[model samples]
Target chain A: AQSVTQPDARVTVSEGASLQLRCKYSYSGTPYLFWYVQYPRQGLQLLLKYYSGDPVVQGVNGFEAEFIKSNSSFHLRKASVHWSDSAVYFCAVMSNTGYQNFYFGKGTSLTVIP
Target chain B: EAGVTQSPRYAVLQEGQAVSFWCDPISGHDTLYWYQQPRDQGPQLLVYFRDEAVIDNSQLPSDRFSAVRPKGTNSTLKIQSAKQGDTATYLCASTPGTLYFGAGTRLSVL
Candidate 1:
């Protein structure tokens, strides 16, 4: 079963501090990993995605993720947090299959303090 | 160019009632997907269609949930009998390349 696991349920950081949200996935073959963020009362927006080639991918809002095949991880990172960055972040994975069925993790809630 | 659209933004119903959610995908998207997002959880794939043909619906609750993408454009998801457990945000997404989601319809069954 292909699944994404976001070990942290909630993370709190002070504004301007570095932030990291961990994500681990369980899949047999190559994985198409993505990070999505949802603000309050808003739809989910794509942060970034990794298909192949480069392991480190940059996303919108100064966010980036490194896909480590050996660790089965694709953790999201930001150099400095902002108050507006407080939202729910989800990690998803899809296989190279034709269907493109996406599996998402429970999500991690980030709270930024000013 | 407009993004995916869904309505009604919110819906409340009693158990055993029937409700349908509508989705209008992006102008030329070939793929459309419906997802259910429970509170504090990730969005789960309910069903998906590729130009009027169901690409996959294995995760959909076949007994009560049914979806249709007539004319390969607009789509609808119907719940024959609503249940409290079905309360969640119903998300509609379309993609020609990368996926773009709608505002989502929040359903609550009491």
Candidate 2:
């Protein structure tokens, strides 16, 4: 069975501070990874996705994620976070099979303090 | 183009009551998914369809939860004898290279 693990339940950082959210996955074959963000009262929006090629994928709002094959991790990062960046972030993974049913992590709540 | 849309954004019902939620996917999307998200938790896939054919539904509570995408565009999910454990936000999503989610229907069972 495929599963995603997001270690942090909540993270607080000051404005302009760099941030990193950890995500790990357990799957048998190659995985299609994705990062999604949800703002207050809004739906989950796709931030970025990694299927192949570049290990580092860039997303909206200056967000980026690096897929590490050895560690089975796809960690989301930002050079600087703003107060508006406060949202719940989720990491999801899908199998390479055509089915491509995605499994999501518990999500990490980010709070940017001004 | 409009994104995935869901109806009845909020609902409150007593335990043992019934409720239903609806979803309309993007114009050209062939894949539609339904997920259940509890407060402060990740969204869990309940069922999905691909052009009127069920792709996966292993996670759905078969006894009381049922979903269908008959025409492959609009979909409905119904829960009979709703329970407190079924109280959660029901989200509808469509896949077009990526998944686009609805704002979700928040269900509260008293």
Deviation from native of the Cα of residue A98 in model 1, angstroms? 1.6
CA shift of B8, model 1, Å: 0.5
Report lDDT (Cα) of residue B44, candidate 1.
Answer: 93
- TM-score for chain B of all predictions: 0.98, 0.98
- Where in model 2 is the C-alpha error above 4 Å? none
Q: Across residues A37-75, which tens digit of lDDT does each residue of candidate 1 receive?
A: 999877899999999999999999999999999999999
Tens digit of per-residue lDDT, candidate 2, span B1-110: 99889999999999999999999999999999999999999999999999999999999999999999999999999999999998889999998568899999999999
lDDT of 2 by residue, A1-114 (tens): 899999999999999999999999999988999999998777799999999999999999999999999999999999999999999999999877887588999999999999
Q: Which candidate is the best by TM-score?
A: 2
Candidate 1, which segments miss by more than 4 Å at Cα?
none
